[model samples]
Target: MADKDPASVQTDESTGQPEKSAQELVLVSEVLPDRIPVMPVYPRPVFPHFMLPLTFSGEKFLEIIREAIEKHNGLLGLVMISELNEQNYLASGLHTVGTVARIYRCSQVSEESVQIVVQGLQRFERVRVAVREEPVQLWEVRYHYDDRAVSVEELKPHILAIMASVKELLSVNPLLQEQLKALLQQVSYERPHMLVDLVSSVLTAEPAKLQDLLETFDMRKRCEKLLLLLKQEIEVFQMQDKIHKQIGEKVGRQQKEYFLREQLKAIKKELGLEKDDKTQEIEKFEERLKNLDVPRDVLDVIREEIDKLKMIDTHSPEYHVSRNYLNELTLLPWGVYSKDNININRARKILNSDHYGLDDVKERILEFISTIIKKGSVSGSIICLQGPAGRGQNLGRPLNCQCPRT
Candidate 1:
């Protein structure tokens, strides 16, 4: 195995940092008693990377620790375990490649408990796992190191682009901008691998996605992935801005319409067309009804409600008639809707299987499923029911109610 100092790498001139060192590496093999209980780390934890310290309390872990302490080397392999069952982790098989880590610190918390800090060094591929009486897993490991080095001139353009994207994203969020700016300054510009790790940590991708990037041995491929991630972050922020603007426009229109209606009502009362300022604005609605072209049946309903509103005070029953009429007209479906097909029996089965009690709630959910299954889909309709209220409670009607007519 070749032992080279990482600091000897060349620095990127533009960023003033050391370049990445390209050195072929070897993985050392370690033995773990199969009975010692082995935990495989799916995500690769790198050396000098600050990760949450894990506590190993199981009997197998204790046995493994005893052996490591006795051996004096204190070196262990970190392997990624394949999940066999979603709920059970012990049944999963371990992945072959894992980083060989050396214990930096170890402390005994209790008679049966042990705490240790291990720093990962290099990557290794596992050949096989053999069971032993000690309850610890034995791993056959082969080290693979990258010896290909790149100069500062080769990585400047990519680094510049990455910095620009970071700046753009930061402009939208000033707090994040400051943090990113500081990180960029602290990072050595010459070493692309370090930059890759730093950028990948901050990206919006999930932990699993980031792990995949870390496991990728190709330096160029890793940089490409990080750049792509940065581009996606920029696009997401832009889409969010567009959505906010659209919502603002919609709200502005609603506010303007409300203000205009109130002003028109005041003008009508002053001109004596309305009997009182408080009287429902039936005349205004009637004029609007005449301007709008619709089916005869809908027109007839609107005209009838307008006539009723003119005879009643603002607080009378007829006042609600006009309000309802306008609401119904404005809220009608102007477009077609594809019916949703629901399976009531399947829904009932699911509800029963997932929950313990609440028969009424389950029944209501099943009813809704039945409706969707029957009609394929229900038309847009509003149904309100008044229920008993408790202090600080806002319980609405149960969902079992049949759909109201549109």
Candidate 2:
């Protein structure tokens, strides 16, 4: 396809803008050359119908830009560097297919660095290196065009689907609206290839995938690939939204619980009931441990349990279990003692009053009472009684009554 005449008043093919004269077009390309200076960009590939701002510091790149602007009608091949090689100026480092761009504006930032804005014109295939030298390198290239054109009726379904996906994307992501609004306004269903390029430039896909889109000249295939990319983008955004909402809801629930708990505390304080049950229980444990003449280790264990009970939440199951354990510990007769004033006559009278038969058992009990009277303490002695159920096995209760302070 031939380049459009710059002098004619027509819609700008790249931007779809209204009538503009040759002077406004900036670079008036009367005749395009096969061999033009090639500049390599990194990471991102520039697509046609888009403006790319580039910065150059090295004298080599600056020389290339000056030559392209001065002699080649501001036309140059903008190719993407496949990998960030130290020798990026070499032709081998750049992709074979590149965009033919015109220098829209150029300005010098510093003595060493220069900035240039370039608008992509069309796609081109680099045939071979026409010149490779110290200051500048030029490549012979063949221009490519959009192949297999399809009418609006043929692509109506895909166009509508693409529009729906784009609207969905805008609804989910507000940041993209301002950037894509003007570009979408330029989109036309008749120009399917241009629409494909416009959408491809904004996709959050890998550089290789986008570069493939740049290389694809088939109109229908490019649109299909774009549709797939849009669907994948939508799924990614939807999942992100779901995860964000879930996190927000969880945080909101926790905040509500905290607020309610604070309100309850304030209410209890106003009613003079703010001592809290857990605090009162802990204080009681401390008081019991202080009064009882417990052993050193027993006191230490009880104090440790009190500290643990203070740290635990009052409403948890573990808290109740720990409180019950402390209660049992404090209830034990730690230092309570009974006097050793055993009366033989009183014991014999109580045993006769309690049981009628078992004369041998009565004699054994009298002997044990005699032993305790001499020993002064019942240490190292245990009495064992065996009997069937409901057969007077509770004889020990009456025997215990004989002791005055046991």
* lDDT value, residue 164 of candidate 1: 80
Question: Which stretch of 10 consecutive residues in model 2 shows the poorest summed lDDT?
Answer: 397-406
Name the lDDT value of residue 210 in candidate 2.
83
TM-score of each: 0.45, 0.59
Where does candidate 2 clash, by residue pair? 338-405
Cα lDDT tens digits for candidate 1, 263-324: 88778878977555334355455555555566778777766766666666777876676677
Best by lDDT: 2
lDDT of 2 by residue, 1-406 (tens): 2445343446767889777754435443434678889988877788888876889997778889889989888998889988666764544478899998889899999997999898887788888988888567788988775553355688778887888888898888777787677788987887766777777778787888888888877667777888888888888888988999999999999999999998998899789888678878988887887777898898889888888998999889999999999998987767766444367787778778777888898888778878887887678876666666543434544445322111
**lDDT against the true structure, each candidate:** 0.59, 0.78
Return the lDDT, model 2, position 226.
83
* Shift in Å, residue 291, candidate 2: 11
The Cα RMSD of model 2 versus the native structure comes to 13.0
